[model samples]
Target: MILTDTHTHLYSEAFDKDRDEVIRRAVDNGIERFFIPAIDSTYTQAMMDLESDYPENIFLMAGLHPTHVKEDYKRELKHVEQQLKERKFHAVGEIGIDLYWDKTFLRQQQEAFRLQIQWAKEYRLPIVIHCRESFDEIIEILESEKGDDLFGIFHCFTGNLEQAKTAISYNMKLGIGGVVTFKNGKIDGFLDQIDLRHIVLETDSPYLAPVPYRGKRNESAYLINVLEKLSDVYGRSKEDIAKITTENSKEVFGV
Candidate 1:
């Protein structure tokens, strides 16, 4: 019953007070793997410290998040490049266009996204995308870059059936998270139609907490809530969902 949280910010300040306890609770409940995504150079040390504390469970990624793309983005990308060269990361991710908050940085976000994808290809690593209201924009880039070397997870996927199929076409596994448990989170409506092989579990924790915990800070242990929802959605046992999604994660992260 091992479960993998393919995208979570365990290093987030939200967990600063009781990080160990939060992680222990998840591990005890079978969510043993936590893949951490990068936002910017600001959290690099914190991310490293988290991995140092839980070497067995923590897998880190290096990339500049789309929302974080600002005037100094080039400097930030340099940091991402340096980290990738100096250490091992399971993926290059949490990167993509995010037009939800503001459209001001859309151009910079697109450039950063494309550059990161090229870096991922160069490093021979999977990419974990952070898409938000920019599906059409992201899909255009993906369509142009589709290839054997360009593949990864579409983190926190909240798209329609056609979008889901398009992401799968680009070798991306849909990263199902707490949103699936929401009454109005539409992904749940068509999830079962997509094969379990193309899906992976996540919490995006400290954010997007599942029902019963929604509107509150989320933790990896709450992944059980997501697993339960998915079990109901796909008509499979919880253990089977855990096994399949964890395996799907391993395929993407190569761990």
Candidate 2:
């Protein structure tokens, strides 16, 4: 049972107190891979430190998050670019248009998203997107930029079947997480209809914790809650779900 958490901020300040213990618990629970997404340059050092400590288990990504976009976005984008050129990262992500927080930087967010996608293509790496309350907008951008060079995961996907199909058409895999266990999450109703190959598991830790741990701080160990829920949704054994999703993640991150 080699579970892969494709999106988790193991480097988040939320785990500052006992990050190592939290990681050990996840490892004990069979989580072997942890993909860390960048929010901005602010957490860069922490993420680097995390990878340094767990070189085999941790993989890093470089990008400017949508909500983190502001008047100084260009500078941040430059920093992402410089980092990508300087070293290897698994992907260019958790990047996309986020309208849930503030629409003030919508234009900047779109521009940044497109530019990051181009950067991902340039580096021959997959992207990890953070689509929140702007599916239509993100779809429009992906539609325009669609090509052989573009592909990645729609991190923390919580959309409908049609949207899932649309994302797949653009070479994006659906990233399922704790949301699938939510009573009103809605995706659970149609998840089984989607192929497991198009799905990857995640926890989006420190957020979106599954039931039983709902509203509490989420850790990678809680991924078992999601894996259990998915076992029911897909009508497969927990070990099967873990194996298939881990394979799917390798297809995305190439690790």
Predicted structure 2: lDDT: 0.95
Candidate 1 lDDT over residue span 33-103, tens digit each: 99999999999999999999899999999999998999999999999999999989999998999999999
Off by over 4 Å in 1: none
Candidate 2 has which clashing residue pairs, if any?
A: none
Q: Give all TM-scores, in the order shown.
A: 0.99, 0.99
Clashes of 2: 0
Which 10-residue window in model 1 sums to the lowest lDDT? Answer: 137-146
RMSD of 2: 0.6
What's the lDDT for residue 33 in model 1? 97
- Report the C-alpha displacement of residue 108, candidate 2, in angstroms: 0.4
